[model samples]
Target: MTQIAINRPCPPRRRFGLSLLWDALSLHRQRRTLARLDTRALEDIGITREQAEAEAARPLWDAPEFWQK
Candidate 1:
């Protein structure tokens, strides 16, 4: 097998603190907005109230870091 070197630049890393903060705030706002939506509106989006709540409860930093294998 031969190894090749590419000159492509790596993508910028996301700031964890900022990412976490933004995601948390977004989740909070989304939850509030979603709760106000009627069942018909939620059905149009193909998501249930339970699903939205669960998603909002997930930690923003749960994904693996892009730089890690």
Candidate 2:
């Protein structure tokens, strides 16, 4: 045959990398939302505006400690 298509599962390394990227993006979006929360909302969440700003300012690649393991 001149050519034939083959199906294969994603490689482990590539899957891990893609998963990491997705997690980082999700964190970025969540942090943005956190940063926009009003005073009441921040109070409801038990975090101050300063704390939210600090979290929002973090780099995307800086995943939470729990996520590292």
Candidate 3:
């Protein structure tokens, strides 16, 4: 006799929404940290303070393109 296999169900809407919210919050926190970093640390990371500030100024909804999927 042959046997059939079952696949897992897709994720629920609530989980996906929560995950997106959490990612946005995390990005906000990271940008806040970047904004708070000293000039020396920014230089060590190869970014100028102005650049860091510019990136940090972006809104939470401005996530990476890959994250859109």
Q: How do the residues 18-64 of candidate 3 rate in per-residue lDDT, one tens digit apiece?
A: 77789889999999999999989998999998899999999887888
Instruction: Please provide, for model 2 over 1-69, each residue's C-alpha lDDT reduced to its tens digit, 9 standing for 90 to 100.
Output: 598667987554443777777888899999999999999999998999999999999988788897865
Give all candidate RMSDs, comma-separated.
Answer: 6.7, 7.4, 4.4
Q: Which stretches of candidate 2 lie over 4 Å from their true place?
A: 1-15
Ranking by TM-score: 3, 2, 1
lDDT of 1 at 9: 83
Candidate 1 on 1-69: residue-level lDDT in tens? 999898998987655787667766775677667777877898899999888667656564444354243
What residue runs in model 3 are displaced by over 4 Å at the alpha carbon? 1-15
lDDT of every model, 2 decimals: 0.69, 0.87, 0.87
- Note the residue pairs that clash in candidate 2: none
Model 3 worst lDDT run, 10 consecutive residues: 9-18
lDDT-based ranking, best first? 3, 2, 1
